[model samples]
Target: MILLGERQILKVVRFATIGAYLGDEDDQVLLPKKYVPSTLCIDDEIDVFIYRDSKDRLVATTEKPKLTLGTIALLKVSQITDIGAFMDWGLEKDLLLPFREQTIKVEEGNEYMVGLYIDKSDRLCATMHTYEILSGESPYDVDDMVEGMIYSIKKDVGIFVAVDRRYHGMLPISEALRIYKRGDMIKARVVEKDEEGKLKLSLRLKPLEQIDKDSYTILKEIEKQGGFLALNDSSEPDEIRKQLSMSKKSFKKGLGRLLREEKVELKEDGISLKKL
Candidate 1:
């Protein structure tokens, strides 16, 4: 049976002016003319993503959405109605987030992390209760780098992520190298597990990896500023972040490396490049 809100490979049963009908066991959905492959023919199988159209009928498209059944994503609220909220999931049909599915009331023009699921009425909907659906069963270990999508952020806790769009992970505020928003895709390294066994992530690169990056940044900055920068190891953390977009510790390390190489000299007020 063809499932909604998922990608399925189905054989083309027939063709029409509008498009090709793909199905198995009498269940079919229209692959719109625009989405139908130019070389597609009857009885030929094509892979397509399935979702309900604006009219609430199952339709097939070659386009893929950011979120699908059993998956969680950060979606923006496009409109709010008395019944519920509509989110733009990059498809013709806006995914619905029914009031019952929302953990909290949502507002228009804001993004929230939501889970995609078919409701009781057989209609695809978005739900904000995403914690229940994330799989903590990740095959990862400390210091392992993984890619993930940011779904939510809490100032007190950290940024929530869906590792590989399946396993759960979080970038703690302490390890966050920069600000991130919902829907941001980032690469992070696993630090350790929290008390609850959830993955703790760090956005900063490993020490050696970061040193090279920081060194490059410092060199580029000195070049940009005509071979001088008004920052030293004693500079405030916030000042370092503003000037170099790096941590105070990283800036000091990079500066120390430059000094040891005789590439720069420490001044009472700041640091200056050494003569070539």
Candidate 2:
């Protein structure tokens, strides 16, 4: 049986003004006239990708799609409709990225990595949930520096990464210097490999102590809030996370460092930067 979203070599069965019909007559698809080779004849086998056109008719094209079924690629958004965003995937018909399949809000002209899959309707579509399609068997080992794109972010959980756009990796939230958004490029070191060989990533440029990193985050936040913050060790855990997006334990570590260094002053209600 022929498959959609895949390249197949089909035999030319007959010709018509519209184009050549490929495959057995009982189950043939059209290769538009523009794509038909002038010298092509019946019984000739040609490679093409099969997909439904704008009119929802099965068609064959010599044009190679950038992404195929079960594979992921960085596709550009060509247009947006109420149904979904259409992405340019090197085909005449843009692939739909249904709103339900989006991991983040997509905008036109921006490129995002997506996996191709046939939806419930059997039409080819793109999905930002690429974790289900990426492989964990990467060619990376511990301490290897690799670049990845943030495909999904779970608060208090790690950011799901697509390593080099093909492998699975995770950048734990505790290791993050700050909050990250989906589709952002990340550079990290492979700290460990999971049982499945997926990478555990660390954002630290060097293997510095986690406390020092945590302290840096607090310091930055204090500075960002104009030399003071309305939270401290006494603040509720929820309040700490509300303001810092970090656990109270981590915040205290950062706060303790700043106090020991005389970088800030703790008060009854808040902490203030130590003004020189």
Candidate 3:
């Protein structure tokens, strides 16, 4: 059976006119001219995405998709109007992002990582605020390490995150040690639940002592690599954390200890082992 507003892998079954209707089931949905891929034949299985047209009519398309329906996608804003902004979703018509539907009005040429869905009007739309769509049980718990896409930031409040795009979490101000703006992806930890029941997240992991078992592994890498590692202070905090999984303060402390013992020499570019 063919499902509306969904992509289905269907066998061509037969050939039809430019505006001819076709479907595997009796519903016999219309395959508009725009949806037809060049030169097709029967019994050939092809992937097609289905959606309602401007007139609220069912239609199909073979356009390379940015995302499947019901799933969230980071789309680019193509145009903006007083009414709304249109996002390029690899379709003949751009998806509408109504003003009321947006967390913030996005300007053209900007990209917004958003959750896409069909609104009450059956029109495809997007929203930066996805708490309503992502509220529920998390496949994670306190102290659990997780990675997420930075969708948006509410200044002074924190950043909104979609953990693996399946769970909801927030990086609070106190624990956001590093400066991060929207679209800056990050690694975080599930810290606790807020009074409002939202997930309280922390960008900083627990103290290194908490990862005692892994400390030996890290120390070994430092030793094998010559007791020293060079890193530019100009590197973004997020990038540094990605490389070392530790905050700048924590990393500096460790480096200082190694240098004080003459185990390593701080160089102009980075750190290197002291040659006796």
Q: Which candidate is the best by TM-score?
A: 1
lDDT of 3 by residue, 231-276 (tens): 6455566765676666666666666555566666767776666787
Expressed as tens digits, the lDDT of each residue in 137-219 for candidate 1 is: 78888899999888878999888888877678988777676777887898988989766567989877788888878888998
Root-mean-square deviation of every model: 2.9, 9.6, 6.3
Please give the ranking of all candidate structures by lDDT, highest first, separated by commas. 1, 2, 3
Clashing pairs in 2: none
User: Lowest summed-lDDT stretch of 10 residues in model 1?
Assistant: 172-181
TM-score of 3: 0.61
Task: Give the CA lDDT, 0 to 100, for residue 119 in model 1.
Answer: 80
| Residue pairs of candidate 3 with colliding backbone atoms | 230-270, 230-271
Q: Provide the TM-score for each candidate, comma-separated.
A: 0.84, 0.54, 0.61
